[model samples]
Target: MVTALMELKSLRKAYGETLVELGSENKNIVVLDADVSSSTQTKMFAQKFPNRFFNSGIAEQDMITTAAGLASQGKIPFVSTFAMFATGRTYDQIRNSICYSKFNVKIVATHGGVTVGEDGASHQALEDIALMRNLPNMTVIVPADYNECRQAIKYAVENERPMYIRIPRINLPDIFDNSYKFTLTAKVVEKGDDISIISNGDTLIESIKAGQMLKQKGISAQIIHCPVVKPIDKNILKLISNCKNKMLFTVENHSIVGGLGSAISELITDEGLGLKLVRIGVNDQFGQSGTAEELLDYYGISAIKISEKVIYEMKTTIL
Candidate 1:
C-alpha cells in the first residue's frame, strides 16, 4: 500500500470537503442530490456552491435523468443518493440515460451494504456492486475508509466517467493516517505466505485485523485492499494467482453473488489458479433492523468470522 499523504477524517465529512475541493477547480462539476443532501453529507457542497448544486427531492429516477441531461451538456454531474435508491430505484435511468450515452456522470452512493444500520434492510444496499458491475462502461469503486474515499473522490473528479463510488455510514478506522497513498486501482496492505485475504470497502479493516490475528497463530495471511472494483487491478490478480499459498479468501460487506467475492472469483479462476478459494460476505438474504456492529456479526462479516474462515480453509486444505 502506498503511504497516504493526507489527513484522515470521517467518511461523510471527507466526502463533503472533497466535493468542495474538486468543485472549486472544475466549474463544470455539479452536485445533484435526491433529498439526501443531509444524510449523504452533500449539503455542504450545496451551501458553498449554490449555483452548482441541484436538489432533486426524493425522486431518484428524476435526479438520475437530470444528471444525465446535465452530463450531455458537458457538465460533470455527480448524483448523490443512498445506495439502495441509486441502484434499485434508478437502475433504468442509470443504464439507459447515463451509461448508455457514456456520459461522465459520477454516482456517489452512501450508506452502502449493512453499514447503514438502524435503517434496516430497506436502507442497506447489499447488491449495489453486483448490480452496477453488470452495466456497460460502469466503473465500480468501494473505498475502504474515509481517507481512501477522499482520494477516490479526487481521482473520480480528475478522471471522469460513468463511475459508482460506494461509502459506508459508520465512522470507521483511519487506516491511512497521512502516510498512505492510493492509486486508482488495488492496494496491497499486508503480505503473507499462508493465504491471501482480498477485500474491499468497509470490510477491509476487518480483513486487516484478521491478518494480524493470523500472524499471532503463526499462519501467514496476506491482505489486499482494492478500492476500484469494476476494472479490477489485473496486476494484483496475477500476483495473488502465483502465490505459494494455495488458499484464497475474499471478504465484502455486500452479498457474495455480484460483489467483491464474485469479482475475485472470476479473475482467479480465469487465470487457471488451483487455489482453494472461499468467499466471506453477506449471504443472498436481506438484512434486518440492527446496529452496524450487530448486522456485521449477524451476517458473519466481522473480523472474528474472517479469521475463522481463514483458519478453517487452511486446516481443511493443508492435509
Candidate 2:
C-alpha cells in the first residue's frame, strides 16, 4: 500500500480522456452515446471529434445497432451509456448485432452497480457483468480505478473484438501508478499466504481497506485485483489456491450470483481445488436509492462489512 490514501477521481473522466486521445490519432475510431454523454463523460470525446461521434438520443438499443453497423464498416465503435440501459435494456441488440457478428464494438458502460446512487433499483446495474459474459464474443472488463480504466479503454480499441467495460458513477482512488503495467491476468495487490481476497472494480477499494484491517487483526489476507472477469486468470488463481490458508473470499459490487463470486466458485469447483469460497456481494437483491456509502453498507459491500466477514469466516473455517 502507498504511504497515504490515494486521491479520488472519476473513472468515467478517465475513459473520456483516453477516448479523446485514441480518437485524435485514429480516424477509424468512432464513438456512440445515448444522450448521457455528460454523465458518462463521453461528451469530452464528442466535443473533440464531432464528425466521428454519433448520438442515439436515449435509445440504447439503437446505439448498439448503430455501433454494430460502424463495426461492420471496419471502424472501431465505442458505445457509451449507463450500464443498466446499455446492457439489460439492449441485451438482445448487443447479443445479436454486436457479439453474434463478432464486431469490434466496445461498449463503455458507466454508472454500474449501486454506486449509481439515488437512481434507485431500475438504474443500478448489478447484472451487467453476468449479461456481458454470457455473450459468446464479448470480453468483460471492470477496471478498478482511473489508471486501469485508461489502459482498458486503450486496449479495447487496439484489440479487435466485441467488449464491455463497466465503470462506476462515483469517484475512485488511484490504485496503480504510472509505472504499473496493465494485463488481462489477475494481479495480486498484496501477497499473503494466510487467505485470499478476490475483487474487482470500485469494490476492490473497499476490499483493500478490508485487507489492511484484517492484517491489524493478525490475519494475513492476500488481496487479488481481478480486472477481467470473463477470461479469469486461472494460472494466478491456481497458484494462490495452494498458498498459506486454503480460504478464498470474493467481494464485488454486483450480485453474488452470476458475478465475480460465481465465476471464482465455478473455477475452484471445476479444478477440484476443494477450497471454500466466502462471497461478499448483493446476495440476489435489487438496489435502492441512497448515497453510495449507504448503499454499499446496506448491500454488505462496505469496508467494515467486508472486514467483519473476513474475521467471521476465518473463525468458522478454522473451527
TM-score of each: 0.95, 0.97
Off by over 4 Å in 1: 1-8, 179-181
Best lDDT goes to which candidate? 2
Q: Which stretches of model 2 miss by more than 4 angstroms? A: 1-5
Which residue pairs show backbone clashes in model 1?
Answer: 2-181, 3-179, 3-180, 3-181, 4-179, 4-180, 4-181
Show the lowest summed lDDT stretch of 10 residues, model 1: 1-10
Give the distance in Å from residue 122's predicted Cα in candidate 1 to where it truly belongs: 1.0
Best TM-score among the predictions, by candidate number: 2
lDDT of candidate 1 at residue 290, scale 0 to 100: 91
Model 2 per-residue lDDT tens digits across residues 1-319: 3323478988999999999998999999999999999998889989999999999997888899989998999999999999999999999999999988999999999999998889899999999999988889888999988888999998898789999999999998888875666678988887777889999999999998988898899988888988888887787666576567778899999999898998898888888886888999999999999999999999989999999998898888862
